[model samples]
Target: MSLTIKNLSFSYPDKAVLKNISLSNLPKGKLTVLLGPNAAGKSTFFRSLAGLVDADYEQILINDESLSELTAAERTQRVCYMPQIFSTQAMLTVFEVVLLAQKQLNSWSVTEEDVQSVDALLKQFEIEHLAQRYISELSGGQQQLVSICQAMARSAELFLLDEPTSALDLRHQLQVMQRLKDETQQRDVITIIALHDLSLAARFADNILLMKDGKLQGHGETEFMFSSPLIEDIYGIEIELFRNSKGSLVVTSELK
Candidate 1:
């Protein structure tokens, strides 16, 4: 029950983003947050999981089985990759938008089983009332919720979410993150979330993978990853970490 990457390395046209990164065993059943600065290769690393780009060297193993031999369709079904943001231009309703996410099914021609599944997902995000609303017409936050419902419908064992709450407000940010955690826990799905919000990451993530300059600087529990020096070094700004009465990690800006 793990995704193992050995000596993983990748790069773009003129530069490398990941350099000889080796993670022997990444724990399952946790929200693994990949944190990094702009152009730090977090996106590259996430994309490489699904073969979005060529990894010069890497041995990807899922649940002890090597993905080297799995077909494209096989990989897509086993591991779902939700990009930083999804765009939809079709004149479709909220329900219709989510139905398209079930790429395994037709957007307009859904069976009773498909409708049941998608409807349940929509309701989970508390957006069932918007079933008839056009996605393009919805607000940014509303659309993000719809996208979340769509992603959850994939029902894959592993969910790769990039900036899942980037456009969400403070309340929705927490709500979505919490919901994501609940859904993953209930289903025992491994979630690797690409995030920039250190406070939210500290609060919700079970484990944190710190990346800087395209290298995996550290990987461990949220508390360990947010050490004063580590946070300051990574963000080039001083920050403080404290514990709330609720036992959640609170990140504060520490003046240098």
Candidate 2:
């Protein structure tokens, strides 16, 4: 499966946000990281993909099928989106939220397989202990994890996550990225994540989509997109790229 966006654009009454953004053939079974400075429209782009915002585009296609043509139920079944902010006021257990998400996407009839699936997801995120805990009572990081679990519970062709690791600590950040990568590959789904941490993105992303001022600045494989010139031009800073002993790309930056 793949995603294609042609001449995509969006605007608020006050100002334009995305300006004729066009991306082609974003492949499935890979983790693509969306990088940008604040107000860069990364969130807006994800929202457009999720059909949460109205945007004009020549086409937004999944496997040659127009995403815009899909019904609300069809879109929900095909696209799973986890926004930066998650609702915490829901007086439900972590397990319930995840299970409900799955049921909403698939069927209302609860099955033993569904219950097991929720349990496995909770265990996968190491949050099985929080299964019985109320969402409102969890910490921010815990809530973030639960939100991700909720997203993971859904079986969708496309996954769009915005700043999923913002509330996570160092360890959980690594854990979440690793799990996301694994899930993307195992499920052969298209996963696009918006992130601020360059190092984390470099370490984990299979592809990079960089944006600035509501426009796409660059898109390519991880190594090719992390060149000093592109990094400096996009962020307006001096930067260095090198390989660590493990051969992982490392980026260091300084104000110009």
Candidate 3:
């Protein structure tokens, strides 16, 4: 099960956002990182994939099935999108929010499996201690964790997360990416995350999708993408890329 996007384009009334972007053979069971500077249309691209925007595309295929053909409910069943900004105003407990996500497309009655799934997600995220607390009461990082739990509670073939680590500390950022990678492989799901951290993207991403000015600057394996001069071109900065003694990719940047 792979994903393919062909000739995708989008625009607002006064401005064009995406311009004939095309990518193919985005393999399943791997983490793909979307890398770009701010206002590079990363969020808009995600919204298009989630069917939240009316983008023009020749085809958006998953497992060779056309995403445009799927009804709203069907698309929801296949795709789980966690946006960059999430509302913490819901009065529900942390567990309840996750449980609701598990049962979002189902009947009102909850199943034992749903309860168990929600419990497992919270524990996996190390947030079982906050299960009873309301989302409105948690800190930003804690709320982000809960939002992740909610997204993971759902059954889906594709996961789209926008800046999921933006609010997290160093430890939690590592934890979240590690767990996401593990889950993506374990479930054979295609997970795409938009991130600003080049080091993190290089560390965990199997493929890197680079965008600039609403255009696809590059798409390839982590090493290939990072080696390209487009990295500096897109961000308008001078960067040094190297592998540390531990053999992990590291990126250091300075203003040009």
Largest lDDT belongs to which candidate?
3
lDDT of 3 by residue, 1-256 (tens): 6999999999999999999999998999999999999999999998998989999999999878899899999998998999999787889899888988889858988889888888888889999999999999999999999888888887799899999999999999999999999999999999999999988998999999999999998999998888889899989988888999999888888999
Give the candidate number with the greatest TM-score: 3
lDDT of 1 by residue, 1-256 (tens): 8778887898778988889887766777778888888988888888888779878666878878787888887888878888876675767999987887885553556689988888888877889999999888888888888888888988677788889899889999999999988887888877899898989998998888888988988888888888737767887878878999998889876557
Better of 2 and 3 by TM-score: 3
TM-score per candidate? 0.93, 0.96, 0.97
lDDT of 3: 0.92
lDDT of each residue in 1-256, candidate 2, tens digit only: 5999999999999999999999999999999999988999999999988889988999989867798788988988889899999888989999899999888846668999999999999999999999999999999999999999989998889999999999999999999999999999999999999999988998999999999999998899988888737767888888777899999888777899
Give me the overall lDDT of model 1.
0.83
Candidate 1: segments with Cα more than 4 A from true spot: 103-109, 254-256
Report lDDT (Cα) of residue 184, candidate 2: 96
Alpha carbon lDDT at 130, candidate 3: 96
Runs with alpha carbons beyond 4 Å of true place in candidate 3: none
